[model samples]
Every structure is written in C-alpha cells, then in structure tokens.
Target chain A: MIEVFFQYDFLRYSLFTGLLIGLLAPLIGVFIVVRRLSLMADALSHITLTGIAFSLLLGRHINFFAGMNPVYMGMIFAVSGSVMIEKLRHTYRFYKELAIPIILSAGIGIGVVFISLADGFTTDLFSYLFGSVVAISRTDFIVVLLLTSVVAILLFLFYKELFFLSFDEEQAVISGIPRRSLHLMFIVIVAVVIGLSMQIVGILLVSALMTLPVAAAMRLAGSFKQMFLYAVIIGEVSVLSGLFTAFHMDLAPGGMIVVINVVILLFVLAFTSKK
Target chain B: MQTNNPSHILEMDNVHFSYAHQPVLEDINMKVSPGSFLGLVGPNGSGKSTLMKLLLGLLTADRGDVKLFGEPVKSFKQWSKVGFVSQKANSFNSGFPATVFEVVSMGMYGKVGLFRFLKKHHKQKVREAIAQVGMEEYMYQNIGKLSGGQQQRVFIARALVSEPDLLILDEPTVGVDAQSVTNFYEMLKELNVHKGITLILVTHDIGAMSDYVTDVACLNKCIHFHGNKETFEANREEMMTAMYGHDVSVIEHNHAHDHHDHSHDHDDLAGTRS
Candidate 1:
C-alpha cells in the first residue's frame, strides 16, 4: 500500500485528502452535535448536492464552466444556503427548525431540475454523488487542503467563543461575545465542511462523515477536549480503513467510510450500554 | 441618559418592551445600585426574565433607556465587569461533554479577549472560582455527571470566574433542592458582602428570598414597589396584590415563624403583563 501510494499520484492525493477530511469533519462535527445542529449539516449537504448538479449542468452548456470543477460551485451554494438558513431561522423565531426543511427541499428541488436537464447522472455526477478514489483532481486536493486549513485556523482563534456559545448561548450573549456573527460564522464553516467533504465522502454521505465519529466519541469521552480528540481519531481510523477496503473491493469509498462509522457507532453504543 | 453616579450599576428608565403585538413589559423604571443584593420577584409572566434580558442587552427595549455601569447599553463595552447566569442554565444541553474547569474557564474568555490564549493566571482564576463556589473537588468531573444543585454551583462558579462587579442570576435555583437553595442564597449574600459584587436574583420565591436579599423589587408588567427588604416584608400584602393583581389569598402556614407567606392566587398569572 505504501509503495502503491508512492507510485501513483492519484492514490497519494486520495489518501491525503481522506486524512484531512477525517480530521476536519469530526472537528466541526463536535460543535454541530453539541449545539444540536446535526440536522443543519444534513440540510447543507443537500444544498451542496444541488450545487454539484447545477455545476454539472452548466459544465455542458457554458464554455467557462466546461473546464470548471463542481466543488467550487458547491461551496458557493452551500455557504449562501447557510446564510439563508440563519436569516430564515431568525424570521421564524419560534419555528427555527422550519428553516432546515425549507432549505433541504429547495436543495432537492433545484437538484432534481438540474439532474433532469443534464439528462441524468453522467459519469462525472455519479463520481461526485458516491465519491471515486481515482476521480479526485489535483485542484480538488488543494481546495480541500486550503479549506481545511482555514477552518482549523478559525476554530483555533475562536475556540473559547465557540465552546461558550455551544455550552450556553445565553451566557455567551450576556458576555457580549458577538453571538450572531459567531453563529453565522459557525454555520458557514459547517456549510464549507459539507461542500469540501463531498469530494472524499460524496454528497450523499458527507453528513455521516461529519457526525458519526463524534457520536461514537461521545459515548466514553470524559470532556469536551477529550471528545474532540477522540472523534478525530475515530474519524481518521474509519477513513483510512474504508479507503483501503474500497481500493481492494472496487467499491465506493463513501459507502465504505459511512458503514465503517456506523459499525463504530453501534459498537460504542453496545459497549457503553453494558458499562 | 447615562448616570455619572458610580454606585448605580444598572438603570432602566421607562423601559417598554413587547413581543410581536403582545406587550410583555410596560413603562418599567428600575435601577440597581452597586453592592446591593436585589431579589426580583414576580408571577410567571411578570417579565422578570425580560427585564434581565433588557439589562443584559439580549433584547432591545422598544422604548426606554437602559444604562449599565453608567454607560448607555448601546455603548457599554465592559461586559467582563457584568456577569449573567440566565434561566437557560438548567436546561442547557445536559449531555454537553465539558468538564467543570472548562465551563468555568469560559467565564474568563470575555476578559481574556479574542485571538488570545488564556494565560496561567486565567487557569488560576478558574481554579479560584471553582474553589469560591466550593466545587474544587469536581473541577475535573464531567459537568453532566453532577447533580442539579452541583451543576448550578458550577454555573455560579462560571459566573464568578470573571470577578464581575455585577452578578445577575435569573432563577439560579430552579432545580436545586431546598437545602441547596439556602446555601446558594448564602453564597450570593457572601459574594455581595465580602466581594462587593452587585447581585440581582430573579426567582418566583419572593418570601423565601426576602430574608436574604438586601433589596426587593415586585414586578408585574411594571415596578409596583422597589425598596429595601424591610419595606417589602412590611408591605407584603400590597406588594403581593400588586404583583398577582386584584385577587390573592394569603395564608400563614403552621411554620409561620419561618416567614413562609404563601399566596395561592396564581390563576390570573399568565399573559397579563400587557
């Protein structure tokens, strides 16, 4: 496997992206799960799916988009959708969760239109939807690398504020932490994570990559820091093992990765329940 | 208008707030002076939480001026000096995977400022706060594993970690046992007297808190009476009727010597803040 990675650039790129996503997904997932905004990730992933489909449709028609990667459009759409979700949640204050379904439906609605117009899932679209180990371009790797770095840096800078808001929003507000901007920043980060993660985990299974490791970590983690550390470890393990298994079996890495996470979740649940 | 008086920590003058078309607070005027332990008591919908929100700038008042630390709320930037423990403390994500030390350290985050790391002194302050609230033994314990009263104490420690001049607690003893409630009040009293921290406690138990607080305010859409504890105890009936409105059946229990004044007329207590 080590020799193979060294020989083939595609293998190296896929492995590198997989490891980075493994870290970034669970890092953001810890906050999402703690804030009870797990559904928001699902909604944003759907929105990214719409972006991917639309980009694929544009790739066929427009000369400019002909050579463009769908991940860029997916990120743009996901970030905008996250901002829109924040606005809509504020508009319907008492019915905040209503925003999730609204965006999810819009995403699916737009996605269906784009997929139909594109004459169905092309080879390109299928690779994005379910993820392909060999399909990751050098540009996608850089984009993921850059996004992961930005997210990690932002998290480090605002670590205390994020924990404060997630732990007790009212206290955060009273402490004058600029909570609205922080929360908006958080959702945008979640959106970008979902968008960037799709290249490795696929649009359909990105939220699982973002959430499942954290779910498993929560069972025995003693503290927030421990939960964060444990989640990243769990995520890295699943991604590496899933990638190896997918390489051997010629299967979708997305499905393999998510199944690995589900197995870990079940094991943790059973193990913790008995203790 | 901003008051130049250094003693007055909070001032809400003619503050009127409403939710949508329904009025929650009307023509409210109140001031919290420094080093005063104020017990804010009212019926369920009397806007105790709303008033706290206004002071904390969580909700902007539709019409009125709210000044904190002698600065207009819009311009007040010294949040580190004002600690607030909201009603949501008890209901905060119970499964949130954080230790007591982490939670207490969050209090100093504001004072520590942004884009900066907590220094050794900050950790020492967190430890000092944990010790202050007598939760030193549980510093490493997961917050979720603590009992309701113990969790409440950790929250108080979080509030005290910053060493704020004014500590605002909105029903801090909601799920705490009776003995713990007494201890919590005693802690607040000690915080007020020894540390000179101004305290505002919002709770439904007016009679129970009357003996502990230095001042009392009866709130029901408006400030019916705001005076010292002696005046509140002396004019209990009038304040009770002003709070509950028109019909209130006051009964003295067998342990009347304990000053347990029970008012069993809360039927008209909901949605009448307008």
Candidate 2:
C-alpha cells in the first residue's frame, strides 16, 4: 500500500482528500447533531447533487461551462439551497424540520430531470455517485485543501459563538451574539463542505460521514470538547482504514468509509449500553 | 418624552405589545432600581415572559421605550452587564454534552467578543462563578447527570460568571425539589443582598418567593401592582384575586421550613379559589 501511494499521484491525492474531509465532516457534525440539524446535512448533500447534475447538463451545450469544475456549481447550488432552507424554516416556524424533506425532494427531483436531460448516466456520473479513489485529479485535491483550510479558520474564529449558539440559541442571542448572521454563515459553510465532500464520500453517503462519527462520540464523551475530539479521531480512523480496504478490495471508498463509521457507532452503542 | 434615569437598572414606559393582533401587554410602565430584588408574579399567559423578553431586547415592544442601565435597549451594547436565565433553561435537553465549567464559561464569550480566545483570567472568573454557586465539585461533571436543582445552580453560575450588574431569572425553580428550591432562593438572596446584583425573578408562585424578593409586581396584561415587599405583603390577597381574575386565597408560608407542607396549603388554596 505504501509503495502504491508513492507511485500513484491519484492514490496520494485521494488519501489526502479523504483525510481532510474526515477532519472537516465530524468537526461540523458535532454542531449539527447537538442542534438536532442532522437531517439538514442530508438535505444539503442532495441539493449538491442537483448542482452537480445541473452543471453536467449545462456543460453538454455551453462551451464556456464545458471546461469549468462541476464542484463550483455544486457549491453555489448548495449555498443557495441552504439559504432557501433557512427561509423555509422561518416560513414554517412550528414545523422547522419540514424544510429538510421539502428541499430534499426538490433537489432529487430537479437532479433527476437534469440527469435525464443530459442523456442519462455516464461513467463520469457513476464515479461521482459512488466515489472513485483514482478519479480525484490534482485540481480536485487542491480545491479540497483550500476549502478545508477556509473551514478550519472560520470554525476556530467562531468556536465559542458556535458552541454557545448550539447549546442555547435563545440565550446566545440575548447575550448579543449576531444570531441571524451566524446561523446563515454556519449553514452556508455546511453546504460548501457537503459540496466538496462529494468526491470523497459521494452525495448519498456524505451525511453519514458527517453524522456517524459524532453519534459514536456522543455516546462516550463526557463533555462537548471530548465529543468533538473523539469525533475527529473516529472520522480520521474510518477514512484511513476505509481507503486502505477499498484499494485492496476494489470497492467504492464512500461505501467502505460509511460502513466503518457504522461499525464504530455500533461498537460504541454496545459498549455504552452495558453500563 | 421620558428621560433616562441613571439610577434605574431597567425601565419600561408606555409599553404595548401584541402577538398576532392580540394584546399581551398594554400601557405598561415599570422601573427597577439598582440592587433591588423584584419578584414579577403573574398568572400563566399574563405576558410576564414577554415583558422580560422586551426588557432583554429579545422581543421588540410594539410601542414604547425600554432602557437598560440608563441606555435605550436598542442602542445598548453593554450586554455583559445584563444576564438572563430563561424559564426554558430548566427544561433544556439533558443529553447536551457540556460540563458545568464549559456551560459557565459560555457566559463570558459575549464579553470576550469575536476573534479572540478566552484568557486565563476568563477561566478564573468561570471557576469563581462555579464556586459562588457551590458547584466546584461538579465543575468537570456533565450538566445532564446533575439533578434539576443542581443544573439550575449551574445555570445561575453561568449567569454570574460574567459578573453582570443585573440578573434576570424566569421561573428558575420550575422542576427543582423543595429543599433545593429553598437553597436556591437563599443563594439568590445572597447575590442580591451581598453581591449587589439586581434581580428580577419571574414566577407564578408569589408566596414561595415573597421572603426573598425585596419588591413584588403582579401582572395581568399590565402592571397591576408594583410596590415594595411590605406594601405587597399588606395587599397580597387583594392583588392575588385581582391579577388572577378570580377569588384567590393567599397562604403565607416561610419557604425554608414549611416547604413540605407547602403543597397541602396550595391544595387548600385551590379548593377555596375554585
């Protein structure tokens, strides 16, 4: 495996991308889970699929779009979808979770329309849907690195504000935290992370990467800080092991990674339930 | 046309609030002096929480002026001087993964501002706040594992961590046990009398809080009575009956000693009122 990574640039790129996504996913996931916004991630990932599919369809006709990275379009759509979800949540205040399914269904519905319009699925689309370890280009790797750095910096800057908001939103607002702007910025970041993660975990399983590690950590962690630390550790372990297994077995990395996350979660559940 | 009075910690004048066109608070005027423990007692749906929210600038009043620490609430940027613990604080998710220390430290985040880390002095303040509430032993303990009363104390510590000049609690003892509730009031009294933190405690059970609060205000969509504790005690029955919109018998009990028999007295009061 070490020799393979040294020889193959694609393998090295995938490994680096996988590690970055691993760190980013659960770092954001802790806030999502604690705020009961787990399904928002799933909804945002589906919307990212809409963006990717729309870009693919546009590329078929437009010469300018043909050379553009589909991930950029995916991010734009994801951020828009996040904002729409926030608006919808306010529109249906009593039924805030209703925003998730509404956006999710719209996303998949529009995504399928674009896919069909583009003359059905291709090999490229298949690689994106299930995640291909060898398909990650150098450009994709750089993009992932840039996004991960941006996310890390933002999280570090607003760590206390985010934690306070997640713990008690009403009190945080009362304490003079700019609740509306922070909420909008947080959701936009979540959407962008989902967009970038599609290459590593695929759209369908992206939310699992964000949620599963945090779920396992929550069962065992004594404090929020511990939960955050354990979640990142769990995420890194799952990604690294999943990549190795996928390379040896010729399986989809996304499926393998999510499976490992599930295994860890189940193991934690079993361990904690006894006490 | 009212001037900002430097002596009042909170002042609301000609305040009118309506929810979806239904009036909640109307033509309300009240002032809370510095270092006064004011107990805001009202029946359910009497706009007590709304009034508190308006004072905290969480909810905008439909019409009127609200001043905090001699500044208009809209322009008041010194939020560190005002701390609020909502009624919902007691009913928060128990599974929230936070220790007492972490929860208390959050109170200082506002004062620390954006793009800055909490310094060593902030940590010391957090420790001091936890000690003030006598939760030093539970500093590292998960907030969820503690009892309701203990959790309430931790929240109080969180509020005190910032060392606010004014502290407002909305039904902080909702699910607290009898003995713990007594201790909670005593701790609050100590904060008010000794620490000189002005308090506005919102509760429906005026009888329970009468011994601790320096003043009492009864609300029913408006300020029915706002006076010193002596005047409130003198007019307790008349005020209770008027604010509740029915006949209510006031049963005076010292919360510290007779809390066990307090429920029986409540049952008797209910029987008479009905």
Candidate 3:
C-alpha cells in the first residue's frame, strides 16, 4: 500500500485529493450544520453539476474549452448560484428556505438540458457523477490543494467572527461584524468547496461528505470546538479507508466514502442513544 | 437636526419607522444619558423592539436622526462599547453546540477585532464574565443543558463580557421563573450601580423592573412618557391607562410568593387589542 503511491501518479493524486477534501468538506460542514444550512450544500453542488455539463457541451464544439478544466466552470456556476440564493432569500424574506429548492431545481433542470444536448451519458460523465479512484488528474489535485489551503487560511483568520455569526446572526450584526461581507465570503467558499469536491466525491454524494461526519460528531461532541475537531477526524478516517477499500474492490470511491460515513453516523447514534 | 451630545449614550430624534407602509414607530424622540438605567415599558405591539432595532442600526429609521455614542447609527463603528441581549429563550437554538464559556467568549470577538485570536487575558475575561453572572461552575457545560433562567444569565454574561458602556436587554426575563427573575434584576442593578454600565431594559412587566431602573420610558408608537423613575412613579396610574388605552393596575408583587403570572397578563392584554 505504501509503495503503490510510487507506482501510479493518478492513485497518488487521488489519495492526496481525497484527504484534502476530507479535511475541507467537514470544516465548512460544521458551520453549515450549526447554522442549519445543510441543504445549501446540496443546492450548490447541483449547480456545480450544471456548470460541468455546460463546460462538457462547450468542449465538444470549441477547441479552447476542450483544453480547459470543467471544474473552473463548475466553480463559477456554483458561486453565481450562491449569489442568486442570497438574492432570493432577501426577495422572499418570510420564506428564506424557498431559495434552496428553487436553485436546486434550476440546477438539475439546466444540467439535464446540457447533458441531453451533449448526447448524454458518456464514460466521462459517469466518472464525474460517481467518481473514479484513478481519474483524478494532477491539475485536479493541485486545484484541490490550493482551494483547501485558501479555505483553511480564511477559516483561521475569521474563525471567531464566523462562529459568532453562525451562533446568532442578529447579535453578530448588532455587534457590527460586517455581516454582509462575511456571509458572502462564507457562501462563496462553500460553493467552491462543493465545486471541487465533485472530482473526489460525485455530485450526488458531495453533500453527504460535507454533512454526514458533522452529523455524527454533533451527537458526541460537547462544544462547538469539539464538534469541529471530531468532524474533521471522522471525515479523514472515512475518506482514507473508503479510498483504500475502493482501490482494492474496484468500486466507486464516492459510494464507499458515503457508505462509511453513514456507518459511522449510525454507530454514533446507537452509542449515544444507549447512554 | 440636533447635534449629537457626547454625554448621551443613545439619541433618537423624530425617528419614524414603518413595516411595508404600516407605521410601527412614529416621531420617536428619546435620549439615553450615560450611567442611567432606563426601563422601556410598552405593550406587545408598541414598537419597543423596533425602536431598539433602530437605535442598534439593525433597521434604518424612515424619518429621523438616530445616534449611538455621539455618532450617527449608520456611521457608528464602535460597537464594542455597546452590548445587547434580545429575547434569548424564544430565539435561541437549543441544539447549538456551544458551552457557556464559548458563548460568552463571543462577546469579545468584536472587541478583539478581526484576524486576531483570543489570547490568555481574553480567556481570563471570559471566565470573569461567567463568574460575574454566577455561571462559572457551568462554564464548560453545553448551553442547552441549562434551564431557561440559567441560559438567560449566560446571555447577560455574554453582554457583560464586552464591558460595554451601555447594555440593552429586550424582554430578558420573559420565560424565566419568578425567583430567578428577581436575582436577574438584582444582578442588573449591580451592573448599573456598581459597574456603572448604563442599562436599557425593554419589558412588558414594568412592575418587576421599576425597582431596578433609575428612569422609565413608556412607549407605544411614540414616547408617551420619558422621565426619571420618581416622576414616572408619581404619574404611574394615569400614564398606564393612557399608554395602554385601558384601565389597568400594575401589581408590584413580592418575589417570595412567586404568584405573579406576568406573561399571562401580557397575553391577555395582547389578546384584547387584537
């Protein structure tokens, strides 16, 4: 297992990307879960899928797009979707949650149109939908690394403000914590994370990677900080073991990772309920 | 427009606010002096919260000047000098994974500024704030595990942690028990008198808080009465009828018996108006 990294660059890239996603996903997930915005991740990921499909369709016709990574387009779409969600939330102040489903439906609707226009269901699309352990390119690995670093640094700088906002937004606004900018930064980062995680965990399972570990950790941890730590640990373990098992069993890495996450959540629920 | 007086902690002049064209507050003029505990008493839909929101810069007044600490609220940047605790029991998410210590530490976030970590002294201040509210023993305990009154105390401690010149509490004792409510008032009085933190308490039960506040303001779509506690007490009966638009008596109950159903009375009054 140790020498396998020396043999194949794609395997090595997959492992590193999986580990980084493991850390980044749950770190953002903690705040999302605490703020009860878990569905926001799903909406953003669906939008990312729309972006990827559009990019693929363009690549089929244009030489320039053929050379470009679809992840960049996916990120652009996800960020735009996030901005729209924020706008719709303000438009329908009384029904803020309405924004999520509207965006989710738009994403899937446009994504299907793009898929059908591009002649539908290629091996490339299947790999993007369910994730392949051997499909992570060096560029994807580098992009994930850069995104993970940026996210980590931003979180460290704005940890307290983010925590305060997540805990009570009204008080945070009253305290003059620059609510609008902070919220925009948070949602944009979440969008980018979802956009990138699509490479390691498929679009369908991306939200599970972002949410399941946090769900399990929420029941066991006593404080917000503890929950954050426990979630990251759970995420890393699931990602690593799932990738290893998938590599050996010739299974989709995303399916294995999400299954491991569910098993962990069930175990934690059972353990906590017994006490 | 009147020039902002630096001595006043808050000033709202001819402040008019509305929600979707329905007027909530109209021609509200009030000034909160430094080092004065002012009790803002009003009925359920009397715009007390909306007024507070205007002062806090959460909502822009449709027509007037609102200033905080000698600066217009729109341009006011020094938030560390002001603390606020809203109706915590009703609005708070019980399942939020935070300890009393973690929650209190949030108060220092604004003071500590952006891009900076909580240092050793910041931790000491957090612990001191918890101790001040007599919640030191439960500092590490999850906030959800505490009773409603205990949670309220923690929120007050959160406000206190900033050492603000002014602390505004909106209906802080709504769901608290009578005995704990008494202690809460005592703690607030100590903060006002001993610590010299200016206080603005918004409540339906002015009878409970009248003993603690130095001044009283009766608000119902406007400033019905804003004066010292002595003057307000002297005119209590006449003002209550005028402000509430009904003949009502305020029962200053003894805390020992704990028989006063303040919330019940509030609901009855609100039910009548609707």
Per-residue lDDT value at A167 in model 2: 94
Give me the candidate number with maximum TM-score.
2
Candidate 3 structure quality by residue, lDDT tens digits, B108-206? 999999988999999999999999999999999999899999999999988888889999999999889989988999899788877888899999987
TM-score against native, each model: 0.93, 0.94, 0.93
Runs in model 3 deviating more than 4 A are A1-6, B1-5, B250-274
Tell me which residue pairs clash in candidate 1.
none
List, residue by residue over A1-275, the lDDT tens digit for candidate 1: 54675578998899899999999999999999989899999999999989988888898899888788888899889999999999999999999999999999999999999999989867877778888788677887998899899999999999999998988877887787889888989999998898778888888899998899999999979899999998999999999988888887889999999999999999999999997
Q: What is the C-alpha lDDT of each candidate?
A: 0.86, 0.89, 0.88
Which prediction has more favorable lDDT, 1 or 2?
2
Query: Which residue pairs show collisions in model 2?
Result: none
Q: Assess the local accuracy of residue B129 in candidate 2 as a C-alpha lDDT between 0 and 100.
A: 96
lDDT of 2 by residue, A166-239 (tens): 99999899889999999999999999889878888888999998999999999999999999999999999998
Each candidate's interface RMSD: 0.8, 0.6, 0.7
> Cα miss at A93, model 2 (Å)?
2.0
Question: Which is the better candidate, 1 or 2, if ranked by TM-score?
Answer: 2
Model 1 docking category: medium
lDDT of 2 by residue, B1-274 (tens): 2433377999999999999999999999999988888999898899998999899888899999999988889988889999888889988899998999999999999999999999999999999999999999999999999999999999998888889999999999899888898899889988987888899999987767876777888899999999877677668668877888664544344433564555454344234322
